[model samples]
Target: MRALVAAAIGLAAAFALILAVTAVGAPSGETSPEPLLTTVPGPKK
Candidate 1:
């Protein structure tokens, strides 16, 4: 029972660490030159 609890806690901590690193490492929209998602212009009638 103790081992299972420990494993769960460890997994949670690792997931949190990964999420923090990814959030911090990613570039912000303002700093990036290109838009993250581009849309095509619609044809004029």
Candidate 2:
């Protein structure tokens, strides 16, 4: 259990680090135009 927890944390940290690096290293002009978060309303049943 301890090992599993440690692995999960490690993976999460690595993912966060990767995202940070990508965001920081990317050129401003090349950024995506789309929003990072989006929601769509569901049709009523």
Candidate 3:
């Protein structure tokens, strides 16, 4: 019973850590790159 509880706690902590890392490491997009230019033509100048 004690081992099971410990394992559950450890799993929860690991899950939380993964979420925190993902949140922190994720790009906030404030410095996002500009869109690529395509070969398609647009309206005449």
| Candidate 1 TM-score, true structure as reference | 0.55
lDDT score at residue 42, model 3, on the 0-100 scale: 84
- What would the per-residue lDDT of candidate 3 be over residues 3-28, giving only the tens digit for each residue? 99999999999999999998889765
lDDT of 2 by residue, 1-45 (tens): 999999999999999999999888956577688778676858889
Estimate every model's Cα lDDT from 0 to 1.
Answer: 0.89, 0.89, 0.89
What ranking emerges by TM-score with the best candidate at the front?
Answer: 1, 3, 2
- Which regions of candidate 3 are displaced past 4 Å? 26-45
Model 1: clashing residue pairs? none
Q: Which regions of candidate 2 fall more than 4 Å away from where they truly are? A: 26-45
Q: Candidate 2 vs. truth: CA RMSD?
A: 9.0
